[model samples]
Target: MYQNYNNNQLCLSIPLEINISSNHVAVAISHFVDSIPDKLIYEKAMTSGRPAYNPAMLLKVILFAYTRQNFSGRKIEAMAQENIPTKWLIGDPDTVPSYRTINRFRSSDQMKRLVEAMFLSFRQLLKAQGLIDDSALFIDGTKLLADANKYTFVWRKASERFEGQLDKKIAGLYQELVQNKVDLAMSDEAPKTDSKTLEKTSEQLTNEIERLDQVIATEPIIPGGSPNKRLRRKFKHDRHLIDSDYLPRKRKYESNNAIFGDRNSFLRLIRMQLLCA
Candidate 1:
């Protein structure tokens, strides 16, 4: 998802005569944009302080950038400024948002809604064009490498940290008990325990228990969420063995191997039949 480039590199520019077509992603996004209910999403923006770019154009540019895996607002802005296809798609070669604004917009709920709407529209269009055969479907999954190392796997760390925290809590409780004993020894009267202090300490212990419970419940024994939920649930049922026997050993080898398998790769392969009318 990240690319490295040397800015100091210079090359001789040569003009070659070759036919190049418009970007397919851009075209598809443009069609989706055109089909959006603009009045619903754009009406509010039109009355704002200064408005120039339409929702369709902005949505198209954002989607195009996303398809290219250029999710960063700064990268998108750079592409808009320098890339011909991006510029053409936006219909504004001159208009480019600052990285800050673009980032804010990208993170907004409105963008999510727009993307969902666009996807639905695109799916409907494809269906109308007889591009989907709903009779048969294939599903599969592959592992995706997290942006972290094997050492970063926190399950073991969490356990160690939890043990240390529990030790500290016990030590604190011991100190409180010692203090109570000292107070009782110094005075003939029975040492009075502060009810509020006891309640607060109890609450802290309860909170720690809740925290541990959450961590245990949500541990990555299996991935959970939409497309992968079924697979994840099945794996969860077998998690104890998977984690103890497979994951640890496999992760150990994988961490040392330079050539991580397709599981670590981002590439996806999907093939479906298009039934044309």
Candidate 2:
């Protein structure tokens, strides 16, 4: 069949649903943040300065970046330039933001409270969608892992129950793979590559499982803490590290609560216990 290409196309003519599947998260968050009145966050808008990206779109892209574990502002900037999901989130492929712009907006004092507000909004959305229960306590971190299904958490007396199953599955796959390789070597037919493919698949799965096992006890990173030593210190308390670092950080956070001028609003917005890790 002959091939055809539209080199001068002006529009994709793609359905919004199919287009958004690259990152449905962007759609969900943008909708929520767009509904937020700007006056609530900024006292007055600056009209004299050069125009910037829409706050709602920027906020959506930033929030989606965090979910993917991309924390560096430079990385975020690059994502805006290169990642289709990010471009789709922004709704304009040409609107690439500079790293400096992203970093400044991210580190702004206004963003601190704005982000909390967004998180509060997100929690409500989750509750409305029946992903999170009414109770505030979050004992299961996997809920944050994006598995919106799977409701129950079973108590486990032994670690091997889960790892044993993984071990058996991996072993069975490996055995099949080895048997296939042996058979291929013995056969006079054309060389078979399925054994090697199966080996690679099993290896990839085993490596991924091992990686998850290694990450189970890792610390939960508090966002926007790299530039603020005080905030990073404060987040230690969230991780249950009540050492010398925690007390001063706690005091500092309390002192800054009023300094930020959003103590009441912040408290009202966030009710969940701070369990970073």
Candidate 3:
């Protein structure tokens, strides 16, 4: 069918305010802030340092920013400038707080107990609404966005025994499958690089990609009627990833790392852990 993914860009425009207001995080945080006793925030209010931001509004921004897995002051400032949801939480489109200001506010003793109290307030609100009872509230890690060192995340492989040799292990597994004479290819169409993939190595990632290439030289990747549709779709995508190419620069790697962008092949890195197991 018409090769694959023929992308065409068309410009579309809409009011930015609507996008901000519709975000559930913004709405919930706004409601939560509004529900808080104003006296709690006003009690700690200071008259120093320029006209201050409304404590409730500032608290809402910090908490909402934390929910999006963003903990860095600089990142929050950047988001305030660009993220619509963040702007909505701030209650002003033009006011992006400085990183230093966000840092000071979040780290200050005045605010240290505020987040905890906010959670308690939320629990109370839930109880009042009969959504929960007086019993202990459970932590949903996703909502909490528990803190971690941005530089120190543990990749899934780090939990496995062969963490360091993860890539090589993947190569070995795919190599074994090749030796066992298994047919991993289905598409007769040429392997297409449809997504921006981070480079695992300068060379294209795995035997599956090379094998798929060899097959595509003779056939198109045909969709299979595997009983497990998800697995089938996953395999097809992994096969395409195999035939992809590595990026050329460190700049590309940084951009890719930020979003954990697609990679030329992760199937080997992923499947290798399975085989090694």
Candidate 4:
């Protein structure tokens, strides 16, 4: 028999936060997560049974695990058991979430959206506290791996630079069309020459060249007939410019814009060092 042992004994109550250091990363995680409005974490409430594990606590656990470089679900579960700071964040002595539960919550679509929102909120908080300037992000020199394709990374600055050069070239071509007296009926003060504008210009040039060809073929020049040679050469030159320059540039712009698609920046890895710091 166990000496004065009772499995159901109630111990003295103590605040979990007291056991965790004020300056510990886990404490920071707890405070940061708690700072986020509850509406973001609790999209829906359970209909029955004991209340679900607090999403804020789950977030704290996940973030604290990441700080410790414990990415694997099993490792995080074990860490939750053995790590005092992490256990304090959870605060429930009897409840240790299974690895499967932890993995499912992190991998869910809701979590994905929530993480994006959290990042935005985190950055805003940093800005308000004078910890980060909009112009600069001071991350440590630690190399962190990201789960995205390197080839698909599109830099906004590079895209803008290329687009500016393309527009300048297109504007030059438009000036040539004006100088040549080509009647495409476009204005000098028209909106910026985007991919659609370029495509329309290319099509107009191609049709004009075809019309010039038909005129040269069907209307034989009488002794004083309007000269076809000059007309044919002008239209052909414009057609060649559109084909060689405008169309290719338009395609490139379209492809790059498609890849960029509402993202002002590439997939950035948030190093735990930066967050914990």
| lDDT winner | 4
lDDT for position 258 in model 1: 32
Q: Per-residue CA lDDT of candidate 3, range 202-255, in tens? A: 133354346545555565445773233433344455444444422233233334
Give lDDT tens digits, candidate 4, residues 1-277.
6589886998887654538667888877777887788788888877998777777888899999998888999999998888888788888666799899899989988799889889988977787889888785557764545534444555887878887887787778788787766665666576447766666776877777777788878876577655665766776776777678777877766676776777875643334322323
Residue-wise C-alpha lDDT for candidate 1, range 111-201, written one tens digit per residue: 8887677677777888888998578765544334444333332243444455455445434543554543322132324322233333333
Clashes of each: 0, 0, 12, 0
Task: Go through the candidates in order and give each one's C-alpha lDDT.
Answer: 0.57, 0.57, 0.58, 0.76
Considering every candidate listed, which one attains the maximal TM-score? Answer: 4
How high a TM-score does candidate 3 get? Answer: 0.42
Order by lDDT, highest first = 4, 3, 2, 1
How many backbone clashes can be found in candidate 2?
0
Candidate 2 is scored at a TM of 0.41
Candidate 2 worst ten-residue window by lDDT = 262-271
**TM-scores of the models, in the given order?**
0.42, 0.41, 0.42, 0.44
Greater-lDDT candidate between 2 and 4: 4
Q: After superposition, how far is residue 254 of candidate 1 from its true place, in Å?
A: 32
